[model samples]
Target: MRFATYRHDGSTRAGVVDGDVVHALPAGTTVLDLVRAGLPAAVEAGTAALAEPEVPLADVTLLPPLQAPTVRDFVAFEEHVEGVRKAIDGVAGVPPEWYQAPTFYFTNPYALVGAHDDVAVPPNSQRFDFELEVAVVVGRDGASLSPEQAREHVFGYTVLNDWSARDLQAREMRVSLGPAKGKDSATTLGPWLVTADELEPYRDDEGFLALDMRVSVNGTEVGQDLLSNMGWPFEELISYASRGTEVRAGDVLGSGTSGNGGCLAELWGTRGEAAPPPLQPGDVVEMTVEGIGTIRNRVVAGVDLPPVAPARARPRTRKRPAAS
Candidate 1:
């Protein structure tokens, strides 16, 4: 069953797609809430009429599939990693240790935009690019899980656009030791969340989700890749992420960029360097991951960004851990 977090008549709700109709839920109106509620048949018991596809699909704003207690985006695609290392620094291939370990970075939860939402180009950023990726949403909670035990933690899957501002990102990382502003702004997710049962067949088929990915901006095809190219599979990332810290059911894990040089930093070189037509103010970016759906948004001026707030620090838990 295809499920979506959508809005109807100004009220946001969880919905299921039945043919061309969008069946909107009443009270427990969200993807996270639906998972928490065990997808009871009782809740899907209403709908006097099926909503028109075009009206609801574009009208109902999308939300990140999971409320996500935490979001750790991992860079496991070798081509992407290699391109990133070599692009500015001229270094090819990741360190052996990088392959041995799963690297990830935390991102702001509030900077999320649903499918069809307008994407703002940050001011002074000439390198505005998109990464087409598949993300895994955690279901059951646990820590120190074995690889064999990792599958149970996954709730579902969705697409992720790790939108990047290359200039600010590159500057901060040199001092901060990793990606900061290069990735801090808005992350786009969804068309809808596809359940684990529906996605299981794709795992380990060559690698990761075996779907073809194609992206276009303002009618121009720029990026395309296969989901099977991931360096680390979802199960491995899940097990590794839960090694010590608890990973909750609603938390989301992103499989960074889908291909080699998929984003501008890797594709067209950075600003002042004259890249191939950087995303102008009025271009429309559209991405589609097979079996999921497509998300299209117009690029607006960075001045349109909603107000920025002070960053929140993740504080240590009040209680310390016990000896294992």
Candidate 2:
């Protein structure tokens, strides 16, 4: 079943999405509430909601399916890693340690926006880009879980756009530290969330989902790939994420960017100067994952801030200490 959080009649409500319509859940309920209540509960609520009044999907405003407690994005596509690395650092291949385990970085959950929202280009950024990927929402709390155990914690999936400021990212990563400000600006999630059970037909025997993934800019196709192409399956990424830590209900895990031309940086790496230019104001980006749904967002100019002050160097306070 597909679940969505939407606004109607000056109020936001959670609901089960039926074709062209949405069945509202009880008042004040949100998708996050359903996720925390567990999938069986969500199924039961959705079943009961089928009798409630149906609202036209087009009449309501969609919101992010849920406000995640935390967001962890992983680079699980080898082609994406290779292409982006080459563009950013002129590196020709993936780092050796990248294969040892699934790796991820924390992104700001508060930065999340809903499907069809407007995203502002980060201030001072000239090279804006979008990453096409799929994300999983954690439904059960677990720590130190093995791949087999992690499967039970899966809740559902959604399309994710990890918007980027390539120029800013390039500068920060040069110091070997961040994709911070470059990424923290905004992340797009939703249209709606599709339950894990709903995607059973797409799952392969090896636990990978053979779902088609695609992205476009301003109605022009930019890239496409299969979810099955991921170097590490979602289960393994979840298992690795739970290592010595905890993954709880409402936490979101992203599958990084898809392969092929997932982002302009990848195209830039392979096509050099001929690659499409970075996103600009008024550009629209759309990302879709089979079995989930599509999320479309438009770029807008950002609020420009005064120039940032450079860090001041501190005086050397420590003497030679008697040449010890």
Candidate 3:
């Protein structure tokens, strides 16, 4: 089943989506709340419509599938990691530890935008880019779960665009910590969340979903990939993340960038940094995953903020002897 959070009559509500119709649930309720309330019961009750009226999908503005409590994005694609490392620092191989376990980073959940929303490019970013990924929403609470255990905890999936400011990212990554301002500006989610059961038919031999993912800039197709290219499946990513930590409902985990040139940075590296210009202001970015639907957004110029000046060195002076 499909679910979405949408605005109707100047207020937002959660509802079940079927084709072009959206059957509204109770007022003041949200999809995130439903996930936190437990998936099976929520699915049963929510699909029943809570005895509320239905609204046409066209009449309501879609929001992110839900407001995530926290977001953990993982790098699960080998080619993407290698390509990005080579693209930025001329590195040739993936890190040794990357092969030992799935790695991830936490991001700003407050900076999320929904489908069709405007994405403002971060200030002073000359290399604004987009990452095509799939995000899984946690449906149950668990700690230190094995991959087998984590599989049952996934509620559904959605398309995620981990918008990036490559220039800022490079500067911070040089410190060996991780990205900050470079990634905090915005991350896009949704069109709608498709439940796990809805995708059962697409599962591959190893249980990984084989969805076709394609990205387009303005009217031109930039890249295409398959979710099956992930080196570590979503189950393993979640299990690693939940090791000795709690993963609760409404938390989101991203599948990172797919291998087949899922981002402009990877493409630039593949093509030797030529052609297919980086995203400029007012460029429309559209991403679609075969089973999950599409999310389209326009890049907009960001609002100006006070400039940060470079640190100045102070002159050294001899310290005066302490008074006795």
**Best candidate, TM-score-wise?**
2
Report the C-alpha lDDT of model 2 over 1-324, residue by residue, as the tens digit: 999999999999999999989999999888999999999999999999999999999899899899999999999999999888888777878999888988888999999999999999998898999999899999999999988898899999999999999888998999989889889999999999999999989989888999999998999999999999999889899999999989999899999999898999998887765268999999999888888888999999999987768899988778655764
Candidate 2 contains a number of clashing pairs equal to: 0
Q: Of the pair 1 and 2, which is ahead by TM-score?
A: 2
The alpha-carbon lDDT assigned to residue 4 of candidate 1 equals 74
Name the top lDDT candidate.
Answer: 2
Q: TM-scores across all candidates?
A: 0.83, 0.96, 0.94
**Which regions of candidate 1 deviate over 4 angstroms?**
37-59, 88-90, 204-207, 269-274, 304-324
Worst 10 residues of 2 by lDDT: 315-324
Query: RMSD of each candidate?
Result: 7.9, 2.8, 2.2
With candidate 1 superimposed using the best TM-score fit, by how many Å does residue 101's alpha carbon deviate from the native? 1.1
Q: What is the lDDT of every predicted structure here?
A: 0.72, 0.92, 0.88
Runs in model 3 with CA error above 4 Å? 312-324
User: Taking the tens digit of each residue's C-alpha lDDT, what string does model 3 give over 7-40?
Assistant: 8898888898877888987777789888888778
TM-score of 1: 0.83
List pairs with backbone clashes in candidate 3: none
TM-score of candidate 3 versus the correct structure, residues matched by position: 0.94
